[model samples]
Target: MLEMRKDLFADERDDNLNEVGKGSQRQDMPGHVTARTRFFDDHAFDGLLHLKVVRSPHAHARIRSIDIAAAARAPGVKRVLRGADVPVNKNTLLSLINFGKDDEPTLAVSKVCYKGEPVVAIIADTEAQAHAARKLVRVEYEPLKPVFDVEEALKPGAPVVNETYPGNYFEYHERFDHQKLRFGDVDAAFARADQVVEARYQMSPIEHAPTETNGTIAAPEHNDRYVVHSCAQGLFFSLGTTAKILNLESNRLHFIGGTVGGGFGGKVDSLTEPLAVLGAMLTGRPVRYVLDREEEMLTGSPRGAERIYVKDGVMRDGRIVARHIRSYFDAGAYTRLSSYAAIKCTAHIPGPYSIPNVSSDVYVAYTNRCPSTAMRGFGVTAVDFAIEVHMDRVAEAVNMDPMELRILNAYRDGDMKAHRRVAKNTALIECVQVAAEKAGWPLSDTARRQTSVASGGAGERGQIPATVIDQRGQIGRPDTRTGGPTQTLPAGTTRIALSKEPVMEGARDGRAAPTQVPRYEPAPRHEPARAQPPAYAPQPAPPAPSYQPASPPPAPPAPAPSPAHTQHGAVRFSSVFGTRRR
Candidate 1:
């Protein structure tokens, strides 16, 4: 059973709704309970063949030779496939969206960047035969020095991890090696601050231990098409990737996916689909490729590790004046999705607070280990943990209550965020107040009176200062000290301002009135004198809604409310047990 706190936002909700706030039975519960639900592996085929792979043993090595003759001749073996058999061997999952360069291979060719990289695929009639044949395939390698730490990989003269990104860092916009965010001058704010706090936080890589490991079954259909039953999290994404790897038209592949035991962002890489389809194409039989427990543990993509260094300048009144963050994402061996994650991490800097001066540089660095992919909240979770912990340290340094400190600096509606977007529908202050009351924590009267809606009042928080507005107006000023563009706003632009008109309600959902047309314009460019034209032409900015007022409207008159539900016979389990004997 779940509880709903309707009293919080009763006016915003429809009381006559059927299922919005009511308990309902899950639609798939019956099938799940009765074990009638079919997973990808539950389907049966007439002539199914199993697949197992020969993995590289060295973390970093150059391949000398691969001899699959013994595996091809092994009992129950139908065929063996190597890197040469793949039509297009190299791939990067985000290449479909034109995000990154091709940096990974379905099967290893001349070099193996990480241990457990698949080098050969063996197809046999039985899984046992496939396992036996996998052992017989021989591969020789020349070991190389490997670097595992993110910082170590970036050092001068460190062993290169991926030839595709030889510098060990993903190049952003073909210029800088890291995503940067700059607001006002952080150095000036730090100089005027009463107290400064700095901390370093590191997170280790975490694996998504799904109950059902990665697996796929591909069978040839009539007319050279293939139907694949896969555990991939995204059906169309896998379909397109498989087609691209096999060098076939998009119509040549069909993917069926549903009811994964668990993915947690682990199955989106299309790891097994390409090989399984290729094996079926070569042998003209249904091929099933599944990772064993050991293989899945060793080779599966995990949440990449992140290291963050946060420095904050705070006033005696508990206002955060400036925040600077430098973070590195350890994108082991290749650029899976870590490059995109770095961009997102940069946007989330100076989290949930209105600091006038903020700057961050987030890097996605490669090292010799298994490539990582998304997990639950891949970019935001680790950094949030680091920031909140850093906040507690800041509170201690200022000798203020942690809860009170959060309320003092909580972002309000209409406040300009560090990323230059105006925040709306904020409730951080109210949430902190309710949390303090529930915890029976005492707070100062000023802290208790804080509201996220109130702005421009005497000594109020979250108001964007004049300095920030001036900085925002000068869109792309080159730093005379550093001799580089500030990288705050887009290059070659002046000032940007929101229109004063209110965009009609529900504009985002396409339910606004036809008269409420949103306005947009491209940021005018001023090209510097150069030998060649600029690499990137600026695109039109998206339509931004007009700013909301600093405060919310007055509440309407109260109507007759529904009777509150009460629990009459609720008993405390701890009381019944008379508390634990200490």
Candidate 2:
């Protein structure tokens, strides 16, 4: 069963000593419990008009015509805006990070590639009137076939979601459908490994389902400035990104947002605020736009669907030496935070292990659906699910304890990573120990000897809890990661082998330390003692080393090919995996 891990937040204690273990009053509880917490919708001002968007009904379609004249003349309607009305229609969420630039437009211009793409926006005297008026804006469309699968989207003849992109993939660093994290020689490591294990994982998109749905209010002020009250998770990010998209200086937009009922990275996207501010500016009056429950459920951005395939090369001891992961993140319809989500997904590949060889290709593939934004840990969360299951599978193949297998190759301080950087404050070893202890499970002496630093420490090693969810029972909550139909998928078939254990060094405290995992085997030991050469003549006679470098040795033999693998058939939407060989 999945357990609640208090140890996960051991670093979250208050500073005061008395408050350490005592139940402390939450600062926001009183206001929240009393229904006094102020959300954006709670703020009312005179002449507040409601804005409603006319969304496309077809998944993919070209607009033959958008007749907004009727909506403009509808009852209580002040104005209606379309794609052409947006001063700066194009936007790129990751331009600062030098990623694929300007893929999403503020409104559907020539075509609507997704079902919910905005066609016309109606501003009216009341929320009811705005909704009624939006219905009057008729849009004509020629429906185009859309590709939903990540792999299918990359196929040569597949329907392109965005015609400007040249393909259904986000291009990065002059390449399409790829972000690579290359470290050591994976091919060589695989050759040395005794066995290879592979598995594919898929996760469907899940809605955040926060207590408060997204809403915003924008008010116009003197000197063409605007003030926005939103529930965006990060104020600075929303302020700057929205300001840039509006073609206005950041100083012109005064953003007031300190209360978010709950947002696990869901509200980070500057989706509603930009349009809300634009409405206030165009109408020269306050505009309030709030997503009712139905709109939020159907149109709000959810976690991207993920599909991942992982292949690992390891010795008999469950010590991983090489890994190859390929992931496709379905950045549906438009690229929002999905590019960064794909980045994070790839970054978490070969999770927390110190492997010697790694190869990862993560792609954020565009498809026809609502644009995905961030969800709690987004990319990392999905990859973590894949890799952990992958690790357990590897352990089972080698007939070793899963926890012991983790401790065997768990990263230690100073361990080099797939990104070519050395790690610090490593805690995987300590993590497994604490987890086993809390579950009242006893560990072998060898397992207990492993340390995070690989050095002696007095008290418990730093907390990095490893929560295990038994495969049988249902894991509650809407989380797709920890519990879902697709997460527990098996590889179906496989072959594995293991090499003999290597010699280990003794700990400084006289205990046996965990053995080092060497990529190359040691040379044979010399058998006969060297004949006692004449005392003075022996050393001097050794020729001076050649000035030129010696030629490199012949390479080792290659490993036999393993069964081919494919990612699990599907996800609702994105996916990537990373590899690092220790």
Candidate 3:
């Protein structure tokens, strides 16, 4: 049951609404409770065949040879498929939208980039027979040194995880190796700040252990098509991918998906569909390929690990003057969806605050491990955890109340975000205030009086400095060797100085424009500088800046809507028959 906070948004509520604020029963609840729902495995087919795979034992290795003769002769073994059997051996999940190159193979070819990468597939009369035959497939490999750490992978002389991306970092916009977000000069703000706080945070990979592991059952149909019963989270997306990998027209395959035990962003990768369909094609029977418990846990994609570094410049009064973030996403052996995650993470930098000076560099680094895929919240969750914890550290550094600090710097409705988007419909301050009140936490009168709608007050909205707006097109050039920005501000350029009197940029009466902060240059990759204790004594609180509305720059074009958004009701169909293309 959900508790609707009607009191908070009372003005926007409708008096006659029926279901808006009421508790409605879920459509699937009845079937779920009674155990009457039919999952993908529930459907039975005549003469069904079971498929099992032989996986790599080494994290990185050059494949020498595969001997499937013994497996083909094993009892109940009907067919054996190798990497060469796949029509289009290589694919990247996002290639459907022309996002990334086809870097990963359906089955290991000349090399295995990560442990548990499938090398051979065996189809048999029974699941037990398939498992037995899977063991008889012999594969020879010459092991290669593997890199596991994100930073280590980016260093010079590191082992190349993927030949497609030799640099171990995804190239962004074909020019930079990392996604960048630049607003104002963070160095200038840090130079004049009373306290500088910095911290490092790391997040480990997580598995999506759904009740039903990744599985798909493919059977041939009339009209030279295949009907697939799948547990994939996205039906059409999976359909599109399977068609592309098999080099068939989209209409050549029909996908059936519904009653998924759980996905949580895991099943969207089309892990089992292509191979399962190939198995049915090889043998004239229905083939079911499902990951066993151990295989699902070890080989299935997990949420990618992340390493983040956050540095904030704060005043004694709890105002965040500037923030800088550098993060690396451990994308594992290939770019499944990590490249897009990097872009999304970069957009979320400087998190929910009105800090005037902010910059970020987010990298997607590959390592010799199981390739990572999306999970709940995808890119934003790990970084949000890091930013919130870093906020508490910032509060401790300034010796101010954590909740109060957040409220003081919370973005208002009209404030300009570090990404150049105008913040609107924000209510962080109100939410924080309510949370504090519920927790019985004490707050000063000034903190309680803060509102996200209020302007010309303590946390005033900011405008992009004229200087920053002018350099929008040429922000920074990529340093290919290190995957970071190589250039800093031009030599001998004057630094912007903050004045005692506080006034918002583009304010009334043509007042002097706000100070232009200097462009940030990241420290050397080999050695990063650590934050030191504040040397100067605390000074009096700076006067609150007065704000005035300014004409905002034209909004950027809206991003294309995600294909997942168009997904609707379950697809329905029925039949059987099957063939293989060598």
Candidate 4:
């Protein structure tokens, strides 16, 4: 949204204007254009058409029957196609490279897997008509038991979503064994250890909000050629899948790309191209399909939600000896890309710390919800949040500074990760050191900072011998508060006192009160200096525009190609279609 000055002047500026003139030198004028403007204007999508699609709403069901009588009768409706209408072909875009087999359907055949799955398509003269007629097509459904929760789906007695997989475990990489860390000695370490810590953490799944939802336009032409315009991140994947579904040669597919809004890993899969191309083939006209925001959210890929449990063992010397992490992930609907996600989380269990004994396990559970897909940062963020919190607890138990404990166990560039691969770009140690210095390492007030006050008077003003309250009113040794900005509270601050007894006696409420922080006195006025804006001047007006004379068309028609050179003269097809028979 931020516009530069040159962009405003490009449209009206004359190419032959003198450099010495005031108009040419005036950069402050509202009207100016940059070179990029000319480039983009010349290359803009001048003739491309847009498409939209209608979706189903059943979470799990079977299409008992479908009647497109009204849909086909609707005005502007080009074609009403279903899974049965798919052309006979042994080809499927799926290969062994990414999938075990090509199990995806261009349109739902017998059963709809998840809610919002595309079961039928209506191509039309305009997108609005296609959408209107889409509603007119009556589809009878027999709703089945929906497995919404991962744990419920995993139960042995639960109804199976896919009979082929037996239970809803999806697929597991059973061969990949978890790494166990056995450092000094667990029994001896626990015997000599001063403390032990354990914690549980939960993380919510997130979604990738790309600006452009997945869409495509397919048009079939003569001689079996098809052109497809797509917004997918992986063109090769889409190309292969589309060709497979339509039983066309990969080389026969001509693909083009528009400026993408964003991917964030959500648009990496081949989603809607096959259906749109199929519509074009059945209708012999261009068909486009674009998903709306609600469809994008429900059908689009979302990061997986997970639960992690961590147990840690430490010694009186403030060293970590053994640890264990158990993680469970919710792999929604199809197991499309969930295995890779679980692998990533399992691999990064140890994080940046060093432990002699480490044991970890990761499980990918399947549910009837929408399939979980890739998001930014992968699954590492989920594990990191749990591990970091556990680290803090270890530091608290040993009465050691958390930052110092991290530095002692932090991994260096050459240290081996849990995968047994040596880390090459490990910056954990330096990152911690820089962040600690920037935040001011040890504050004496932390010791005196009581989490909760008792009913009686304060215990003997527990203050260290050589510490004093700083200018910001935070008690700490000199230079400890030099890391960054100090905490400052408003003047006349006072602590609020509450009763020692909980408000509700003998109540089984399962809610924890919000954590409150102690206040500090405000610091003196320190206003940062502001920078000045750049100077600008007005531009001079341009001279009267020189009108060019109109050029006349040629009187004679162009000559046609010779028969010998015309190997099946200029016949073209929409690139989205599979292929044409010459």
Top of the candidates by TM-score: 3
Cα RMSDs, all models? 14.5, 19.4, 15.9, 29.1
Candidate No. with top lDDT: 3
lDDT (Cα, tens digit) per residue for candidate 4, span 1-582: 432334323444555645433435444233334433221112223233333444557777777888889998998877787877755222223231322223345566655657876777777777677778888988888886677766566554654554323345433211111212222234444555567788888877677878677777677756776677777777777776666556556666776663455778676566777777776766666667777788888888678777788878888777786676777677665555565566567667678765554556566665556667667756677888889988888899898888777766665544434443444445465566556656876533433221111211122112111111112111111123134322222222211111111121111121221111111112212312212111011111111011112121111221333334322101111122112233
What digit string (tens of lDDT, one per residue) describes model 2 on residues 254-347?
8998799777767887768888998998888999888777777777888999899998999987879889888988888888888778767766
TM-score of 1: 0.80
Model 4 misplaced regions, further than 4 Å? 1-54, 86-103, 173-196, 221-223, 397-399, 442-582
The sequence of per-residue lDDT tens digits that candidate 3 reaches over residues 357-454 is 88887889989999999998767888999999999999999898999999988998778787556776778898999999989999999999998877
Name the lDDT of candidate 2. Answer: 0.68
**Which scores better on TM-score, 2 or 3?**
3
| Segments of candidate 1 deviating more than 4 angstroms | 9-17, 456-582
lDDT for each of the candidates? 0.74, 0.68, 0.74, 0.54
Task: Score every model by TM-score.
Answer: 0.80, 0.74, 0.81, 0.62
Give the candidate order by descending lDDT.
3, 1, 2, 4
Against the true structure, candidate 4 reaches a TM-score of 0.62
TM-score of 2: 0.74
